[model samples]
Target chain A: MAEYVRLKPEPGRTVSDQLYQLGLEFPCGGCSACGGCRVRLVDGEIPITEGMREALREDELAAGWRLACQADAAVPVTLDIEQWSARILTDNTSVAFEPGEGFGAVMDLGTTTLVVELVDLATGDIRGVLAGLNPQGRHGSDVMSRIEFDLREPGVLCEHIRGALGAMLAEVAQGREVKEVLLCGNTAMHHLFCGESVEPLSHVPFSSPALGARTFAGSELGWKAEVVTFLPCVGGFVGSDLLAGLVACGMAESAEVMALMDLGTNGEIALGGRDGILCASTAAGPAFEGGRIRMGMRAGDGAIDRVEATEADAMRCHVLGGGEARGICGSGLVDAAAVGLALGMIAVSGRLNNAPLRLDGAVQLSQADIRELQLAKGAIAAGLEILRRQLPVEPDVVRTIHLAGAFGNYVRVESARRIGLLPSWKAPVAPVGNSAVRGARLLLLNPSRREAMIEAALRRTRHVDLGGDAEFQEAFIENMRFMPPGR
Target chain B: MADLETLRQAIIDGDAKTAGAVAREAVAAEMDALTVIQQYMVPAMDEVGRRYECEEFFVPELLLSARAMKAALEPIRPLLAASGAKPAGKVVIGTVKGDLHDIGKNLVASLLEGGGFEVIDLGADVSPQKFIDAVQSTGANIVALSALLTVTMPSIKMTIEALKAAGVRDKVKVMVGGAPLTQQFADQVGADAYSENATAAVTAARRLVAAG
Candidate 1:
């Protein structure tokens, strides 16, 4: 079954085209290969292609189901479209900033998703929130891939991202004047958006020296905002998003030992508080983002968000939207792996005891999937472990793990620790949802905080070269064992 | 004296300490270091490489076995040098510039060392000049290039061009391997071979040496 949305009737426009224009995330990126953009026709004659007939069942075809990627809108039709609710992390943190004249906008331009929040600065109220799959995704999924694409075709990335942000602004702004807009993203996204070449980011001694703040006018990016500001990037893969995360966590202000981990496709880990900061980006791959998994899908309706292993060794899945299981997302993947461990269904060496294990009779977990998860979790854990060694304070002395980003917000603490994705500690983990966006919002509300953040980012934070850390390699190998640390 | 079968089994089991102990015991029993490596250690690692190719052993298992062979080879290095014994081949390995990812490079180095190759590991983010310098200084038979990121994959060609400019391109066989590399890329970059993984890297290195 395909998800459908009822848009204001267009005489000749297709349902899929309308959704794509509205920024609905088609996982395959405007391709018909995955069939993720299927829509069910509620009323009117929508022509379905031969390819759709081959992929869809007879009952589905009879019930007016059509592949959105292939269907055309010939008449005014109300089709059931898959609604999107991008789980963006935006929890306010650090010192509050002063209101800047009129309404403001804050954006977190993640590699996969673009989340924008409209705020009324005068009233201190969030006017509206809008999110969509990054149209820049048509270029590539990860930073490295995006860099490669940028190197190949110079100007396309900036155009795509800027256009997508423009559409999003048009939707959420609702004719209201936004005084300023602030963006926080990884180094690649930041460079691509500002039309900076990524050639410097791709080779030896990899980093651009000129990663300071930049401001643009409304005419520049085709937006109504008076000014748009992008935060500074901290060398290597740890972009402005991480710097924003630091601002959100207030690493420079407090003497108390604290660590902030923004878990995502890249899994940037930073540790230390007052003495100094040791930060590194772990190439955790796309496992946690449901990349390269057998039945992996982005977190959305029908995606299995949670998994439980019954005492009888049965797999129970809790899907989003309370429907039949479609595919497992990141949180569910971790829970299933942890549950498999508890039941001895997966060996400590990351070999699944069961072959092609059926889950909820709708999904399957393969041995390769377990290994992918292990590799991903191991990289994150090893990165943290390496950061610990470089810090002046003992790792045990550090308290309050600030888990940033969406994956951090949703993943169970016990499961994360058990899987070694998060370092094993008794200290409370503060899941600061979307600290990047929150930090950007804070900066947007108060321009003064930007200087403070820049100062803090420059003086206090030190980028640890994990690529040179031998302890990291050892930690990575040792952590490859699926069991928790010291087991 | 450490029994030959027991030594081989120790290496196969990935027991580095036991493999080292057995190799030392064998040397103490009036056996030649080179002879011990040829009779037991190399054969064990070769079996592991074969198993990896056959899908009997995956990455973790293969890496473990490589570590065991490396440990066993450590005690014999001094003796091999004192006796003027030469390794199977000399391998110059490093992850290309702009790519800090060394896991693949390190794995290939470990596997090559286990296969009785003298590996000069340049580590990650090595420049083209550095790779050429290592090849010149070590007189390496093969230079294995690794790049995990697609953005950095072009370094393979740059390194190859450097090798040619130094008039040593033909002297050393170039083998490239990484997540995003392929045979077409290897051909385009003028590398002699392209390996899909560490185990295959060792095989390609051995084949390159043999062909030259």
Candidate 2:
């Protein structure tokens, strides 16, 4: 096994000389898209890699540099990728709604990101879209971490979250005439919003403040709107996000079977039929959002949105914004894993093939990247399998799979199917862009719709706690193999 | 007469049936219960604790052996009580408020009990005042707090402060453990000990008691 250590550059020490042991050229001499050349900062700084030069700013490079491609164990290096480099798509559209026109705003409070959209109640036409980092993320990135933070500060941490949401609402409204506000988020996020503690949501027999949709005056949250509605939660972990996704996909109205999935920080999936909706939330972590992986980014400019194994052992990438590839995002990650598996570039256990396959000119899929992707894909696949077992129908019985969220919007359905991330079904795959936002929009548009959402939230049943479910763990391990079952 | 040495070896080996029979034989022959517990049971559990710290044994094995030791001790409880034998210490342990996760707490309690500490497990969602009240009523030497949620961690600190306010903080050592807890955090919160797992909790408690 090849061992690489990332070193930080110091005054006396040169990075190029130290990285000589790794046997890579300074500029990595490989495809600039091959982000393998990036090195982690262990202690000192090294010169920036070509990928980092474009991805990072002058101040970031001046602080210290490390190649995203050629990391060496010779010294410690600090990581210096520009935060903006992680973003794939930039929305320049401004909020444009007239005040007192009965416009409403809907918000999806994700763990990593917060997205707010303004809609015209009469036509359901989107007026404006805005997104920002969830300020609560500074406390911790995952739900478990945030819960820990809440325990320490009591209501203090929750106040920070409310403030962030309030600011975003004010921004989205932008002096527009908003009559109602609708919000959709996970159960934990909802609990925090209502000033209810989330500690109960982390344990077994998980409980929430309320399992159904709730309504309060917008004034209650100090919003300018007349009424504010929160989409109902199904269980402690499976919240209104899944329900809203289901509703937006028109799953409730359809007699045909369907699965609604919101693949974000947590992979919340709801599979239902005319019988009823069964839901589960898997702790996929933030790997898809670029938390755990090396050189991973959100779907933004300079990110690798797609990857494929070329005729030779080389990898081809479709970069976002037509720039030098900086890092891979969630959709691109799925593509890389699926392609790697198909080409035998990665083993069922998620080990990269010993033979080096070029990503760009220089970077290659290391063992760590493979392991990270395995963990991510495994959690998702396991949740799907667990939900399948609890459902009354077979996998084939499901007629449609509606993928929601920005990550889902960018992923190619065939790549997802090829990776066994989703079950093999004959149903056509449809992308419902930000269904949480859409459902929130519905609540914003009509007071009756808000009430219906609350009622729908109350009716849904949450199935097995993914963390405590032994079968989920078994499925996770089985899915980690990455090969078709029985192979 | 095989001396205390031979009997202690039996207990350490976790041969509960043999240890119980030998203990009975020794008592019938006029041996003291306190001596059997101190010279035999405590030593055995101490070895178990050491083995656990070294990773030679995991949770299931430690739990099973503790069970065996408990089985042997059960029949001699009355005898030990009559002889006025005291436990090493008494502890009140539970998961903090708003957190209903208790597996970690239960495991630590079992290990503490096995280590000859009288453990009173209050279960999950225990309020800070409840911990203080338990310490006051039970006259426990230590309060073990567990919280799996970061959100609930403040409850651990609150319980400790509550104990301090009740004038019982000096009477008991505050020990906090959980997945999210670190030694630095425990120190910052003014806790005397922090352990990552149940076995470490036993070791930390023993060290705290010995130091006190």
Candidate 3:
């Protein structure tokens, strides 16, 4: 899950300072904890500090392993960045759209990742794709952290993300004229990118006044597109990404009630049909995406992406690129937890019988890791339950569930059900990859559908604030147990 | 005596139904309700706290034990109050303004209650004025503030400033605790003390009340 990069460190700046622009992640916020920002001295010397001694083992230090946040290279050096070549989900489903004039671009600006795709506006064809870790990650990993970061240093994240995304847009529109550009992200990203205040979002009853659609001339954002627009957000934590997901899945225009869930750090859920749409956001921490767990990383080279209980007593794992497993990602974590539950290695109470169930080389599920997943999956499960009760029809009327986002798309439905992460609904579950970008692509191709769909989404959607809900507490605690679905 | 012992074990095991049943049996038998809570339930919660501190239990286990202790205390509450048993102390508690997270705050409140404190829980997103008002009205000597987010950590200081503004700063001991909190932060915010976790919060509250 690492790649080498040559850098000439500034005399005073640390290694994190010089390489942060390269989307290098410091999962522990570069506090020299977690040892996640480790870099090997490929060609030059990195002086080992006390932090390296504490975080790295004896053999690891002897092999030139150093914490990037602690050590700096005096001269030009090639150091291997541990979190590189991330597998961002850009494979979107096809949609019919009205032909437009020329080329266009669509971007799904996530809190952790950025994806930009160039599209042939007249033919509905994807020309090129560019994806990277959102550089704002260096500030903080989640939305709440980003808000806190922005509160301290106002508008820095905004300017940083805008600059990063503008570069992506420019690269996506290389020389060829892009008629217009469409972008969609969660409410935090939407607000940060549009230069709106995150003050209201940082408090109780978290909703913002500036969630409406924002438009700017492409040149104004240092890009060459004719028009650039970031989509509007639904109320509360339900961001425009879920709105775009609704559009992509055609939920609001459907006959039967369906559910769309984007299981990111902020797990957003929407339930409705042609009648109406109900959305609520649950603070599902980054457990699903391998945040906070020891030996956790993004789905990249050498990350364990899948796991299975081959027999009752044995476990097996599949790494991403067929090498030694450096870390485990969300999908693999779900599978491991499910497998643990099946084998009775992990109790329903999230206790590890043999504490720290080793999955692959250096990757193990600790007791704390199980608790984190419980908290995360509990939030999502409870959110779904709360939204289901509010539906006009029967509680079990949801016919299908459209699992959006990379985690949802890549996660195994059977494993999710086994751990009660997903309910045992009598319906088909479909993982529509990158629905936000696909919805944005739809809007880019057919501008005529934009105003009406946005209006409908705004008018018909009811945001349920889980914080204020009375039943939410009980539901969340109950869902925290890793029971079989429907039990 | 056997019922009280069963209640104690049930609380430690996080068996709410068993704890509640034992508590009801003790109440029906007219056992001293205050003695049941002061000696058994409190000690049971302390054992749960010890287990949590040593990593033998996690948050779920702590919360489960809290819930069970709450169940055991339910039927004993009225009897203890009717007998005119004074609580250890009155404490006002809430998550600070701009922070909606209340799980950790609720845990502290539950543990405080189990420790025989008359907890006036104001819930999350509580403003500074609310704390001052609770202190003035309830005559509570301790105010506990919780903030989960780093952005809302300043609210703890602001709440303290409001207490000072209202001229009740000296009258009440302010305690702060959360995930991102530290002793340095408590000192910076002019708090009387800072506890790292819910169990320590009980000890801190007891010390703060005992100091006066």
Candidate 4:
């Protein structure tokens, strides 16, 4: 167990402000939407705020659980705030990266996050890692918003991403000879960073204008790397990131039918094996990223990233960066939905039992929140069904579900199954940790790996367009319910 | 004789099998097909439409009720044709260029059929010229255009302008719809009418058809 610290609240500000001013890590960014920072009252009782009422269950509210963002400690209430821990997906399970001359790096350009990792070229050792929230988030949370911005003004996002990478490069390089950098992102990010016009991607049938690999010198980004090579996009919204994931998992050559699902703001599903692969991407929206939820945020310090319910219906939580609960982040939202289902608080139609699922009368899941989850999960479930139907493989025959992306890596499989986020199946889940980044790293370390990915993108895989499929439309409406469509 | 009350109740309950069987029985029993429709089937859909307008009935509920009504109407279709029963109106509908989504378009078509109109669904990804050709061929009184994407919504105005250029603008009523379309946008596009949802589309179609 981590040590709990007792701290006095500064005059009148909420507990969240006190922590923020203290320069402590609170992932909620002090947004009331994510009760990410919560400090429990160990001594005197503090009246719960309205926002807190929705986040905490009945027992939690009674037991002195209070939102650090919502509850202001007028009198220094002895607070029990646990220290933080981050469950980052740092496991490099892909074919080990062998070293080279001086050094190299791999970057995962996520819509919401930017992660840069510096590696020792000779020994294949990860020297240092830097992660920063994607600076382009000021425009919007999802890729679609970024696309709109691109349409309004060309080359704006390209500058933003290029500059951000440049800053990151400066920090990691430290005047060392960083020979090459491998980058992988979704179709939109891939286009923006490479200075490609996003005219084609802004509309439907998202055809990438310049999907081929491109190399940019360090001078281009005003950084230290000699060259940065972007991975090629496969098709449609299925970009180089997915190709990277496919490379990391080594999915193309397997004899047995397998599936890879990357759960994120957009859900990309692939079903294939020795037979040609079929991939599709659905706009699952930013529900998993804390977008469009009453109480949602990215997984950060003080965020409720895991949740459980007792036989007596009391709610318990596992917060990321384990301190007092700040707010429910993406992983926590999935857990709450699962736990809510278990307690019969969320109905099959995704309707809440009555009001929101109240955790200590401080945290609640509103009816609208359940609907948003339904729409988001429904799109993914439908997309998967479409891919399976187009292919010869049955769900039972697909022996493994390779869950990719940071959301897929950290999310509990049982929770995913409970919410129908992942298909209801008995197949073993292989948590391929941030397969895109891993794939990028693999490509950076080895030339054969790069060749394999390019071959798969050009020859072995077919991108299935489900936009107008009747079966997919029917499945989408049916999957909108909490229950599986077939049932 | 088959009971009209049973026919109406089947439609309201969304039971297609029961609705079809009862409708077939009524037609075989020498009941006037138009009489059965005016008295029971139409009234049943009217109730569903009312509930839908009031938000008591949602999309799924509205769809189920429409399906049941169609089941009953299918048995009466040939009989009404023999009797020279006129459709309430003729409508041609399609989602505009670059917008392949069909949910809203399909809903409006089903609701139009429930409202006693003939709808020729052009499916999705339809162009302005295609809409013009359809209007010229079908001699439709109303043209329903849908576009879900803000970028694609301009196609609706193009279709309307195409009608004017073809000198058939006065012949048909233009109804523009989709999620991104607002009344102001619809008016700016020179559409005769705008609807927020499929249920409202039914009402707007009826108003346009009646005005003529």
Leading candidate by lDDT: 3
Please provide, for model 4 over B1-212, each residue's C-alpha lDDT reduced to its tens digit, 9 standing for 90 to 100. 79889889888777888899999999899789988988888889888888666544555566678888889989899999999999989999999887788987998998899788999999998988888899999999999999876667767888888889998889999998997789999989888999988878888998998899
Candidate 2 residues B20-90, lDDT tens each? 66666767776677777776777787787786665444443455556657765776677877877788788
lDDT of 1 by residue, A83-149 (tens): 2322222343456657556788888888888888787776444556677888877777788788888
Q: In model 4, where do residues sit more than 4 Å from their true spots?
A: A1-96, A300-309, A313-328, A339-346, A352-363, A456-458, A484-487, B1-14, B35-62, B210-212
Error of 4 at A31 (Å): 19
The 0-to-1 C-alpha lDDT of every candidate, in the order given, reads 0.78, 0.69, 0.83, 0.77
Give TM-score values for chain A, per-prediction. Answer: 0.79, 0.75, 0.79, 0.78
Query: How far does residue B120 in candidate 3 sit from its true spot (Å)?
Result: 0.8
Model 3 error, position A435 (Å): 0.2
Clash pairs, candidate 3, are none
User: Against the hidden true structure, what lDDT does model 2 obtain?
Assistant: 0.69
**Shift in Å, residue A153, candidate 2:** 2.3
Write one digit per residue (lDDT tens) for candidate 1, span B63-182: 788888888888788888999988889999999887878877888898889888999999888899998899888898898999987888888899899999999998998999999999
Poorly placed runs, candidate 3 (over 4 Å): A1-96, A392-395, B82-84
B25-135: candidate 3 lDDT, tens digit per residue: 889889988888878999999999998876577777788899999998899999988999999999999999988788889999999998889999999889888899899
Give per-residue CA lDDT, model 4, range A1-487, as digits (tens).
1113334556666655655443234434344455555656677656787777877777888887777665566565555543222111235244445557788888888888887877666765455556777888897777767877877888888888888977887776667778889888888888888888777876567676688778888787887888888878888878888887777666776677778898877678888875778999888988887778887777776677778887778778776654666567777888898888888877765757666676532556777777778778888998988888888667788888888765765677888788888887657988775777666766777765567656864577888887878888888877776673344
Backbone collisions counted per model: 11, 52, 0, 29
TM-score of chain B of 3: 0.97
DockQ of the candidate models in sequence = 0.44, 0.11, 0.34, 0.35
